[model samples]
Target chain A: MNWLIDFFGNAANWSGSDGIPTRILEHLEFSAAAFLIAAVIAAPLGLLIGHTGRGAFIVVVSANAARALPTLGLLVLVVLLIGVGTVLPVLIPLVVLAVPPILVNTYEGVRGVDADLRDAAYGMGLRGRQVLFKVLTPSALPLILLGLRLSAIQVVSTASVAAFVGLGGLGRFIIDGLATKTYSDVIGGAVLIALLALAVQLGFTLLNRVVVSPGVRQVR
Target chain B: MNDEPLVRWDWIARNWDNGGPSAIKTLLESHVVMALLPVVFGLLIALPLGVACARWRWLYQPTAGLMNVVYSLPSLVLFSIFLSVTGLTQSTVIIPLTFFTLAVLIPAVVDGLGSVPEHVRQSAVAMGFRPLRRLLQVELPVAVPVVLGGLRVATVSSISLVSVGALIGQGGLGNLFIDGWQRQFYTPIVVGIVLIVLLAVLSDGLLVLAQRLLTPWSRARRRTA
Candidate 1:
């Protein structure tokens, strides 16, 4: 406990390249980059599959297969394959980890929307595009956002692996500290990562409240 | 970027022994032990807790909230925290992994029990079934499919995650990743990834088979529906 206090209270720990703030920034950078790429790849694909109800079996089965992939194994293998000369090694596995939840959630969300709602939109003479965008997207927003939130949090938690590959992140503290037998640094890094995850969870909860329609927000 | 080939069958054959702690076979045994124990323990704990939450309703939200926070914490972080008390043992890995399984399984149990139709409960009672008998013979068996759904997720994730235990020196096949990384040897890393993913898939397949065997009625109902 004293060591934890000392670890946090040190002014030296607060600034510079190896400082807590800098490590946090690196962690967030990795997480955000991976998350954005995963969303771009998965969200639209999930929506289309959900709307058309085609190829969903393949999409979902692949996603589940992807889920069973070990994150640490993937991270190390990628680094070994690509060389850690670029962030791509770190980002590749993080993106892979982040994609399945968003894809599955978004697919389930859109597909789960009531059949009556889709018919009503189509009955209004709306185009397929309008029906998907206006009716399904909004209706599916909660689960879509749930998927995104799950992906975002997962990416944040996993972004620590960047440090294992000699990149910069809070995980550097844990890995470095463990190597040096510095328990305080390991605990400090773990604490910071946990706090960041909680903040992400809260942020999504707030986002859910603000963006989800009043009627749908209460459904969960 | 040395000239080492991506994988060496010779290395694998040489290292795979039950003789030493560093042997791939030993690491694999420990990995299986570390991974499976948590799901078994978590299921044991979560069943009653989940039933209580489902029966009480009010307990569900807080329990779920706590579990979500637990789930959000990185496996590495959890491993480190447990290091203080468990001190670099398999228990350190198993304990946190159990929390993770609980986070997923509790919800599955709650939802599974909740899925039992009200009319089903009434019919069970009307059939003069005791509360214990009604729960075990009626509600739980019906909940098997949904509970198995959650169990599959828990099982696969657990198998994959046990590798992360390597940082604290408890990572089963995860040790291969660290060994490969430190030595810049691709063989162990490739082998580790292949084995861990294989383990996850095989375990998941077993669970799916268990679900099919346990809940034969579920498939029949789905077909009719």
Candidate 2:
């Protein structure tokens, strides 16, 4: 009971040198950068393979293989190679982690599209590109968005690994607190991470609701 | 690329003599020991909790929701929290890993129980079987495959996650990998990766075999001589 009182009373001590505000912003920035970069790279590749229906197995296998890499191991390797303190250590593994969900979702989404709708688009003399843009992509958007939601959540959680290499984020609090045996500081960091994960999950859930077609909602 | 020199293998060859093999053996044994307790402990706690949650409507949403939140947090963050509270030691690693396994195991159990056929529950009720009896005899048997599938995933996930414990100085195969990274010794890192991958595959295969053995009635039987 006294420990709780002391913890709350000394909350300011838990703030650390960069302070809460800067740390929060840095965490958000790192998450956003990793999510966006992974989405940009993976979404198109997924769409292409998904639409063509030729490389589905290859894409899935590659993505799964990438995911199997121990993220901390990869991060340590990257830090060793590039020297720590840059965003690359965080970004590289995050991209690797984020890609599998997007790629799998994209492939599932495109393949899940109605074949009859695709045939009708083809019969209308649309070029392959037009068919893809007009028919496949719109149909696949809802699922792709689902993938993005998952990717966003994963990237946000994984960005915590950045603290190991001295990159700034909410993880800094947790890591430093652990080293010093500061329970309140560790809890504060964990609370922040838990809250951040919930926020991302909620944010994406809203996005999913908005972007998902009414037809899909009806099916649900 | 051909003449670029392979750094990973060279390091392994140099280190094999100086307690490296024993270190590797200890690492493997410790990982299995660490992972085994949580999995067993989690299953023990979670199975009943899950069954209770399934039988009672009021407990379902809150219990499942709590587990989901725990599941979503990265293992590293959880380990850090545990370390701060408990101080760095084996318990620090064990407690968090166990908690994380609970997060997975509870849901899998609940989902498995939920997947049991409605008719089975109905029949059990008609026969006036007690809740415990119904669960033990009917629901659990029906749910075993799905639950086992979840356990397989949890086991694989735990193996991967246990590597992070190395960061806090708890030795495992991850220590090998991390040591390599710290000293720029590529060989042990490569070896660690290979070993981890092989472990994952072997564990997954064994789990699948276990599942098949346990749920022989669920799968189509092969024609035999």
Candidate 3:
């Protein structure tokens, strides 16, 4: 317990590239990048499939296939193919991890929208894109937020795995500690990741309260 | 590229035993067994808890929240935490995975029980049935699909996660991964991915089959109606 406080209190642990704060920043950067890429790819695609009532096959199969992929295996394989020390190797798997829930949830959320509401939107002075972004996306916000919550925690947790490739992240603590037999470092790393994941979950819950429409939440 | 295939097909062919067994085969078997053990334990542990949650209603939120936190922790990190407590062995892998699966399975089972139609429970009560019998015979069978859905996710994801056990020098097919990565060969990596995916899909299909077998009345009634 004192070791933990001592570890944190060391002024050396608070600054520069090798510091705790830097590692945390690196982790957040990777996680944020992965989340943005995943959202950009998955959300619109999910909306398209959900809105048009098409591409169900892709969503179902891809989600299953994506879930089944071994994260470590995928990570190393990408690194092997792309050569090491690049962001793509780590980011690709993280993106893959984030994609399925977002895509599936967004698709289901949009597809499950009340048909009458959609028709009502169309009957009003709205066009197709407006109908989608305004009517369907708003209606699907709860589930979209649900997917985002899932992805946020997933990325935050998985960002630790990035340490395996000698990248900078909270994962570095665990991987390096394991190699050096530093029990405190390993425990600290694991605790930090657990706390980070929980924080991400709480943050999203708060975000949901603020971002999601009250009507949607009430329905939920 | 020097006539070397992207993957060494010849390696796979040579490794194939004459309808007997092989190293990869053993790796796969252990991989599968380790993955399934957690799900088996999780189901056993969760069933009673889930039933209690359904009956009490109050237990659901806190337990689910706790489980969600468990679910969010990365498996490798969990295994590392356990390594300190349990020492370097399968216990390290099993304890974390069992908890992780429980995190998801408890919610599924509880919700499944909750989803049993109100009229069905009412009719069971009216028929002079006791709670235990009604749970086993009436409610459980009706809840099979929903429970199985959660089980399928747990089983498949757990299979991928057991690969994290490789870091501890324990997971089955995952060993091939460490071996291949160290050697800088592509074959074992490909083999590991294929076998892991195959195992997950097969396990999922088996659960689906179990659901079908357990809930025949649900399907039959729908079909006949």
RMSD score of candidate 1 (Å): 1.5
Docking class of 2: acceptable
lDDT, residue B87, model 1: 99
State which candidate, 1 or 3, has the greater TM-score. Answer: 1
Give residue A58's lDDT in candidate 1 (0 to 100): 63
In model 1, the Cα lDDT at residue A87 comes to: 89
Q: Which candidate's DockQ is highest?
A: 1
Fraction of native A-B contacts kept, per candidate: 0.71, 0.31, 0.60
* lDDT, each prediction: 0.89, 0.75, 0.85
Worst 10 residues of 2 chain B by lDDT: B1-10
Cα RMSD, each candidate = 1.5, 4.5, 2.5
Error of 3 at B182 (Å): 1.4
Write down the lDDT that model 3 would get.
Answer: 0.85
Task: Tell me the deviation in Å of residue B158 in model 3.
Answer: 0.5
lDDT of 3 by residue, A1-220 (tens): 6546755667876888978888889998999999999999999899999988888998998789877998788887777777787787779889988898899999999988999998999999899899999989999998988888887777886778768766689988888888888777787888888888888888888988898888877887
Query: Model 2 residue A82 lDDT?
Result: 61
Clashes of each: 2, 0, 0
Number of the candidate with higher DockQ, 1 or 2: 1
